[model samples]
Target: MESTPKHQQLLHLLLLTTLIYLSSAISIQSSFPQEALPTKSGYLTINSTSGSSIFYTFYEAQNPRTPIYDTPIVIWLQGGPGCSSMLGNFYELGPFRVSFSLRHNVEHLTLVRNSGSWNRIFGVLFIDNPIGTGFSIAGSPDEVPRNQHDVAKHLFIAVREFIGLEKSFENRPIYATGESYAGKYVPAFGYYTLKKNARLAKSRRLNLAGVGIGNGLTDPEIQVGTHALNAYYSGLINGKQKMELEKLQEEAIRLTRNGNWSEATSARLRVLGTLSNMTGLATLYDFRRLKPYEDDLVGKFLSSVEIKRALKAKESISFEVCSDLVGNALNDDVMKSVRYMVEFLVKNTKVLLYQGQCDLRDGVVSAEVWMKKMKWEGIGKFLEAERNVWSVNDELAGYVQKWENLTHVVVMNAGHLVPTDQAVNSQAMIEDWVLEKGLFATGQVTQKPSHIGTCSIG
Candidate 1:
């Protein structure tokens, strides 16, 4: 049939528009040394309203039971109060791990496939948070966030931009997660995002489903007090040293009460330092590791010209595992408790706190100690909930205790870094929780209530 000239012109325009839209939907996935997940790395220019740039590496869920859109969105942040998310990207949970090697006259690192990468079930986004960390940079020192609240606000903008960049991610269930210092970052950001979503019209809001924290340092006052207990029980300190450690923690709490934030963190670290020295333990982060923490491998790998050009990493800034500049800027917020923010989410949504059982710092002891003092509606139920063995591949991997809207997981035989030590188990745990689609699947529902698991798990 013969069509009118104007009709034909309109048809051409429509086709052109559709082509442009499809192109924008999927970003370019670069080839890597270890070809595993369909991954893309880039920077989200904080949003014009809040002019900061954050670097991110996004990997779509590999081998998902449902479509990628149905799979949960997991944003991972590594903590040092200033650590690069790239540290998590290469060393912990991401698909490609840096293969470290030291040779005569030179040392080099390479990428290797991580079979237990979390990307197997959840779409993962690794972000360099709070600005001025890793490849993310600020034009001046004034641009960096000075407090936890500011850090959350900046991250909120960055995530919004990230979702906008890919239209397919607009409606997915979003989860904010981090380890270590992120204990403060996750709750603050989750609370802020949830509140903002409530205020905005439905069409203008971003969906924030829940939050997960691994070995977090959220409550300065309470967490500091656990050092003495963890040290004594782990056999890292004698009774005499523990007594002195308890005194130091008391001093830290007093400083925290008096609003001396920086001094509080300092006091707490000194207690751990003494324990570390006397016991000859290498690092408080991981009692299992014989050697000290080596972030130099990550720094060298990222700083390599070959890697930068291959990934099209455009950031002109140098990469560091932990940024001293960021740490110094945020010292004043070290003692601030994120309990209020976490409590807000606990009332409305779900919160997951997964800890390494043997970690001397930011482990089960600290989490349980501070959690008891929280004002969340779930506190009573969480406390009363029984621990149950969680199995992966038909073998017990961890213990889970949940109540109301909060779930706590303890990965046994694992130190500070759960993913690095018990990767497959941790990945299975995450997938089951997200797909099970329960706010808090307490063990009592699956089993009867008890103080601990009936069987030795993990």
Candidate 2:
């Protein structure tokens, strides 16, 4: 049978359309650092309705083992409910640290090699998550997430798009990691991925392997209750001050229980502020420091024209360390707990929760309080597991406890930002956990169960 001229023309058009779609899908920009490890930066459209997108920077491992595809990929999210993950990239664990200098009263910013970069063994992806935060763009104010569910959905979409676009990332084991408010973000994202994967074909599933959180606020109710005791025991507050803080804590809890979310968030802030005023502490994040850690230089550098071009960031969007708009939009979510997500993740994924000993905000005491209240089946074995001393280069670094798929570490002499305060130790800790070396390898109480039950908190 002879085909008509119109049929031939339609076939040609279909082929052309397919080619254009394929090219665009894989057309990621790789125009970043030539001297640094392989790096790529781009934006993934997350919400078509709002024209919202998430900006991300990915650095391939500097020294991956044989069969590089086996090397894990870690996606890092910074907490502010509004903070940029670039802070995690530049200040904590990226290929390079941003060094600031003043020459002749002029400020200069330069990148210096960090000996403790997490990317030394694992590919690291830093994301400016939640529309309106950092370089991530939201077409309208309405796009900013108001709760963890939306935050998780956006993150999941961004990651899925990224992996589908970048062929190298396909089939690679991925881990969700972050700190601070990311504690909630990390678990929420992990749980969302697992739930989504359950319904997808094996080849289409995201290979989400584990989750790691450092000094995170996963449970505000329990964590907020610890501030007073933490202050009083640390000698920062006396009995009278402790009681006052306790009263404020109770109010916050009551508001949260009554579902006065925004009011509860305000109450929580007041409690923190009162504790700060009474104790004369420079910052609640790290009690050892007389002044708060600053990231002003980071913002300045990221917002620079040269960096915008290098990172392929939009020149119109100036970088911010923390987005107030994003924070305000999530005010009501501040006191909400994502502990259930963490509980679900521990049952099906390897979970690493670490706290810096010196961190008063989400430190060991606060974490321990929440852990005791956790209803996981493995809680009994985890509590009985010995906390072995973790050391780096023959020096005591922290303590590690492992049971089933759950691992906890207490980093000594560190603050809220473990990677920044104790870079070397934190790097070692992540490496060991991901690679199953050292304490993580030797500290298992029982082989991870094939099936685990769900848990809830009151």
Candidate 3:
């Protein structure tokens, strides 16, 4: 207490040094993430409600635009409520393939070039969501959503977080694109984003531009009705088999009318089974494949020691192409219709509905039937619009029709996976619509310009 002037001077010096040190530390902390630019395969962890950790990867544009801010981002979701978006990555539109022979083994696998990557024009994001799907982990069973709304909310959080972390995405136009079950997820997420952006106008929640669903299972009641007709017209079912399919469809319709989603789903599956069980050579997802995806290929590649290390993935993580546990948990949600969400999207932005010509699972006709009936803006114009052939490099790629901002396309010679079957053509279609509309040349008029029904362009 009775210190000399010298002691006071030393104390003052020490106080000054500490403050300088603290300031320097704060500056360093602020600049900490200047670590080398993140790689294309970067992870995004979304802390979702009910305590779930959603995992996602952004494969920056395959051919990213310079000054990257000008480029666009498209989030790609896989169909299964539990399926890994990695399926879209390796098998459909991502830049890399698990292996040349994805049919079986990943024993000597490599990441080969995918000519059909959507990243050619936009930065692509793949998410493993719904708590326990793919490589995503849930803190508990409570984290998993029991309904479509909850799942979309989690993804909404994820998208906001992604924009915050990835500065490059802040100003770019974004799209929500998915196939199969994604018909529901894409629209739900799009509607959620639209509402969120409206509330937070000062915030740029993905600069959402549009949504595209490819051969998706969106409206089950309307879509399931097309199965019997799809079977008969595709020459899979005879007149008698067609009649039997009609019975299954009628049963499904009755169940749906009575609010029995589970049974309705079962009935729809039976309608699909009419063709599957009879053919002994059913390629519901594809006309070329006899069996389902080779799940082992993705499992082995993703779970491998070297690959995981490269992506900086967690240790002791298991990978599933589609998680039955997650699927089973959301079984009821999947069978319900998301037409309202689609209606909201239709009124707001460009809505692209693409169907693969060969898909028996949620084919083109199902989408066409419901879309015409939906009470969205311009439905009547869409109903009466004439079809035109869109040629890619002077070859027939698909048939396209436009009504206001809504676009409906039926890709020729493709199955459930349009990009996988018709990568170049698919790219041309997406690029034209999303970035430069009315860019591709028109070819010989599509078959029955009166109907724009179906014709091979390739």
Candidate 4:
């Protein structure tokens, strides 16, 4: 049959469009490598109502005594309210640590196997929590959480989805763990999990076994109050200077008491900034170091084309170590106390609170003050418990105190990031605490479920 010139032109245009589409697809496919990741990684929609999702990377235990499915899972949430959990993953306890090298004046990044990864005997799940941080995507600006309540809620949903996705994860003991700002998060999540579990059927409950916090800022009122004393005692300030800092601390406390939360957060920052100005030290995180701990390497590595492709991260969203947007949004919630949550968690679950000896912010003194203030039935017993010397391979690692379900440890020669400062020791601490070894062998820890069962999604 004879065809018109218009029909012939339409056919040619269709063919050209199909070829271009195929070419674009091929180009996109070629950009990413064909290799598989060593661990399971992906995003789970946590809030369908708000269109939010969370990104996670799961590493199975490398040397578990039992089957992989039966091994305990540690869900690590890095604090900053805005900081990415990837920092905890790469800089601290992930199976691989990011290392850098210079050649011909150009720096190269590489991942090296870490001997002290926390996943040695227990599965580790690193989550970039709360939307709009790390690779986690928020549907809109409104989707970003403004309070610990929303943060815990999002995390709860994400974990429920994760467990539902994998049949074997149902029965595994889960520990909510994190450091720094996550001090609030860990307890909030634990408390929320317990609250939710109370109403849910037995088969649908989250198997939350315990909670662990390291150098965390759980109670800002008590924690912030310790700054002046800690600084003065550490020789960063004199008596007169201490008095001045105390004035600033008092103002922060007043604002916190008045419920001017944002103002309190600002006041807290001012207190820290003033201390930094007076000390002229490298970083309050670790005063011994002459320079600040740099995380530019981590930002560089995670944002690279190759790493993003490997982790299934969206290329459109840039990776940041911390998000100021998130920080600003939660300013009002910062100075508020989560002490009640901690008190509740300590009663219901195994609570391990640890501190780095040298950390001025949210460190030993601050934790001690709050612990003394806790109205828990075991507080007296905890304070009276004998402080036992903890060692790793015959070397002094730290001092530990245990009473009932609570354990507190003062890690020697460590600072804000204990895992990063004392890798081997921190790893050993987690392994022992989770497995109920050494000082944690008091036999009062929560028992793991003996039978494995699938969780039904409500």
Candidate 5:
């Protein structure tokens, strides 16, 4: 009951004022999101294998937005090993287009207005992964997946639970989409889901439709080869480096052809990173040449401090010490605990492989090489037609090459994150493919804008 010191009393008063201001600010901010959107978004939580809970921001399609649910439910997965789907959400293809500053207000783009957002005909899901990404948390380190198979299992289970509880997305077509290292992740997860679906088919719980891997890392050998070839052609290599890479490629191919995949794989993983100008665990798939702001609008979007803060705060538990952990082991020697997903492709799960011309990491070199080798018994010419309505050089830039149902596109001037770099093209490609129509089959696909306003070049 002693009288408070003047300074102490002043401090208390300041704290009280600050708290009130912050409370009102948060309330106002919260109301803004709900008020701005034509449709209201809710939240859903699911438990992972380790009992850690994962949170998802669910934007329920409104009556006007109702057609979206009937279309496709796209679950986007970004590939940082430590990256969040939010990267793809805001920077790439989410409903809300983030502002230039990472720490400022966002510019929300509606499907009706943009005609480019996937929300026009798909329910987009931006997930915070591994329990520590974004606001999501895991119960323990074990609850998180150190490998691809476990990640696929847990995520699918979570999605299943969410769908069940919502009861609105049960029969919706589900596709897995991601970029960069997701090259490894997307296929592995897709394979796991396909296998599990086969196992649980009679139970009728699984609703996986197909998979879309945009400039993904599905094959290790191809990834390294592409990196090396791209470096060599793009002048990232010099005399000795070029010589060594050529020799290494020959030797690796010899080993792979001779059934010595492990040795060849180890050699490639070791050399490709250096030759390709990559370093660290997830470096092989990063664009070493372009700094964030200088590249294009997409790069600027990806470079936002807001996304960086959110990603930097998340826990990254991926084992990317070697390429083998992320790519197909049969073609490489790097040993990762994750399972190879070529078997899944063999099982006829709809697989789409698209590439961006400027994605120096895992360029079309790899996808082209891999697809050529995919012995799909399905009927279709490798480069049959201009599947993408948005084609250049009669090449379709993107094409429906491999499987009858499976398709691939190489977006012109786009980078690794195709959707972000070329959202219109990417969306057009996806819409065409998903609807069972070729991207250019109609010969009436919308053309890319000649002028993109003040937006930076991507």
Candidate 6:
């Protein structure tokens, strides 16, 4: 019953939601039909004061008539704190959702036709964060901060540099979005940006709009508590251990009261392991990848000979290439990012939390509990909407909860990654919420429905 960040919990249903879009987009991008995406791929570096350089890849929307500055820019972050945004770019949302197909152009597709990609209206920037995941490398492992504030400071410096180099992006409304471990990363970064803005009001360089997180790892206390509780409810653990877990939770709470998180987490982890039935590695019983992927679909659409021909002809993107990485570094980075996010939340910044329904690591039960704890308040009132699909146990499982300038939501039929799990549905909800500010202004779901399909308890 270890709970994930509220954002991560709600995205468990995304696989089902995005299946249709993925099928169609794959067909078109593979040359089964003509497909187009809005993006001009490039890379940039942000040099940190600690002498570490953070690398990021930009995907600018490419429309013959539209200028780059005209498109809203979204900086995408993949969770794991150590995971690569490239995972989101290729496997999840970006312009072209990449599959493990050894195929050519078919491997990726445009965000618009994909129905789940943020590309149609957004200029996407995929960052390999914390200077370890993907291509980003740190000068020293020790340079990475254990506390969240330093992490935010370094990341802010990187983002600020990117903005300085790309002046056009300055004018465009900028938003940050991510999933998994990002629950903390997004909030921390957003807070840092707001702090920087306050300091540089005279310069007026930053044009940040908001922050978004999907299937995030939010507060460790609540999330971990949910993780243990859910496991018991889900029948992953039993009898004496369950009672022991409850007692441990009580102890943890008491420790937190006494400002002893180390003891609290230590006790919590021991109980969590029994509750989750961990097999050495930390993972939830539900929402783990249920099946392996089938064969690569690349050859079915495009021939290797054709790809070779295109390459010989000197084409821009004749072949598809997956991201390359070494080893162990990614895992290390994820751990570091997690610590940083926890520190970031104390700042005054806007945060948007989202997730799919099918995700177990981060799930709806946890989200409900999380909202209650956040002491949230909306800047504007919530709007009632038609055809809301968020529900569980005969209660509207979703809510448009807010705090200051932040908005947190749970999407239907999504999993660990909402954009990838339920691309179209998730995208529709996020786009409206973020770009149009619909969560604050229009088409917002106010009351939870009594049921979704048949999963309601009542």
Q: Is candidate 1 or candidate 6 better by TM-score?
A: 1
Candidate 5 per-residue lDDT over residues 1-458, each given as its tens digit? 89999999999999999997765552111111332242322223446344465545444432223454465777777665545565565566766554432223333322123335666566766666545454455565445566666667767766776677655677777777777666666677677777777777544555677777877666655545555566667665666677677677666566666767578666766566566443232333335434441222333333334433333322333312122222332233232322247435635656667887666556777667666666554423534433433453333344334435556676766777677666777777776666656342322333343332222223
Candidate 5 TM-score over all chains jointly:
0.67
Worst 10 residues of 5 by lDDT: 27-36
The residue-by-residue lDDT of candidate 1 on 1-458, one tens digit each, is 97679989999999999998766553222224647433777778864555458888899887767777777889999888889998888888888887765444234467788888988878899999878888887657878888877888888888888888777788888888889999999998998898888888986677888889999988878888888878787677889988988898899899999998888878877877877786787777778778766666778777766576655566456778899988888888888898888878888877889998768888999998888988975588778876776766766677888775788898877878888878887787677666653323533335643333433322
Using TM-score, rank the candidates from best to worst: 2, 4, 1, 3, 5, 6
Candidate 1 vs candidate 2, TM-score winner: 2
Candidate 2 lDDT over residue span 7-123, tens digit each:
889999999999987655532111224565338887999878778999999998889974667889999999998999989988888888777766544556777778999998899
Computed on alpha carbons, the lDDT of every model, listed in order, comes to 0.79, 0.86, 0.75, 0.86, 0.55, 0.55
TM-score between model 3 and native: 0.84
User: Any residue pairs clashing in model 2, and if so which?
Assistant: none
lDDT by residue (250-348, candidate 4, tens digit) is 999999999999999999999999999999988888878787777766887887777887887887778999988788878888998999999999889
Off by over 4 Å in 6: 1-51, 62-70, 101-114, 201-204, 234-241, 247-272, 278-350, 375-406, 437-458
27, model 3: CA deviation in Å?
Answer: 51
Residue lDDT tens for model 6, 1-458: 97688766557557656875666553334332224322333233444455456656566654422576766777887665465565676566765553444343345422234556776566777776766454555566765454456656767777777777666767776787877666766777777777678778645656777777777766655665666566567555676666777777777556655656556646655655655554232344234444422212332222344432321211222222222231232322322224233224323444566766656666666655554554323322322133344433333435455434445676654556666656666656566665545334433445444555544221
- Compared with the true structure, the alpha-carbon lDDT of candidate 3 equals 0.75
Better of 1 and 3 by lDDT: 1
Per-candidate TM equals 0.87, 0.89, 0.84, 0.88, 0.67, 0.66
RMSD for each of the candidates: 17.1, 17.7, 17.8, 13.3, 10.2, 13.5
Model 3 regions lying over 4 Å from their true place: 1-43, 48-51, 64-66, 101-106, 288-296, 439-458
Q: Give candidate 5 regions above 4 Å deviation.
A: 1-50, 60-69, 101-115, 201-204, 235-240, 247-273, 276-290, 293-343, 383-389, 392-403, 440-458
Error of 6 at 305 (Å): 20
